[model samples]
Target: MKRRKVPLRMCISCKEMKPKKELLRIVKNSEGKINIDLNGKLPGRGAYICHNPQCLEKAIKHKLFERIFQQKVDKEIYVRLTDILTENDEDI
Candidate 1:
């Protein structure tokens, strides 16, 4: 019998494996655009987090996104990301 390997992703906030798609993807493209990878098809360095404001807030507060992307996240970008997450929460 052979064992199947499960695909796992580390959540930037809780730092646990929940699954790939279960976590929202944050991608930094070659051109240096940081955005949520809703389609999960972008080619770049990626980070994962749960689709919750609290998780996102925790990641932002601890600067985990910067660590994951290896780039300096500007204050304005942080503000926009928070706003985007807030809107997503409302839609959910």
Candidate 2:
């Protein structure tokens, strides 16, 4: 018997391919709302980023998140994104 392969996703910030379950997924729903998808089951355009503050900063500074979503990100949302990154770091 063969083991199943794990799905891999590329991080928008670091541009590194990592296991999907290890990275966090940020998604923009049909209504153009952006939020973190903990379950990775949200239906919409999504972007991947490592759970690292440095990557979050890079992605925000370079507007990579906006590029992935094809829309300007809300300032408040970016703040929340950073906060979330910090919080995730605390968990580790």
Predicted structure 1: lDDT: 0.82
Assess each prediction's global lDDT (C-alpha) against the native.
0.82, 0.90
Question: Cα-based RMSD of the predictions, in order?
Answer: 2.9, 1.3
Alpha-carbon shift of residue 30 in model 2 (angstroms) = 1.9
Tens digits of per-residue lDDT for model 2, 1-92: 99999999999999999999878899999999998888999999888999999999999889998998998888988888788889989999
Q: Quote the RMSD, in angstroms, for model 2.
A: 1.3
Clashing pairs in 1: none
Estimate, for each residue in 21-55, the C-alpha lDDT of model 1 and write its tens digit.
Answer: 67888889899888777788988888888767888
Best by TM-score: 2
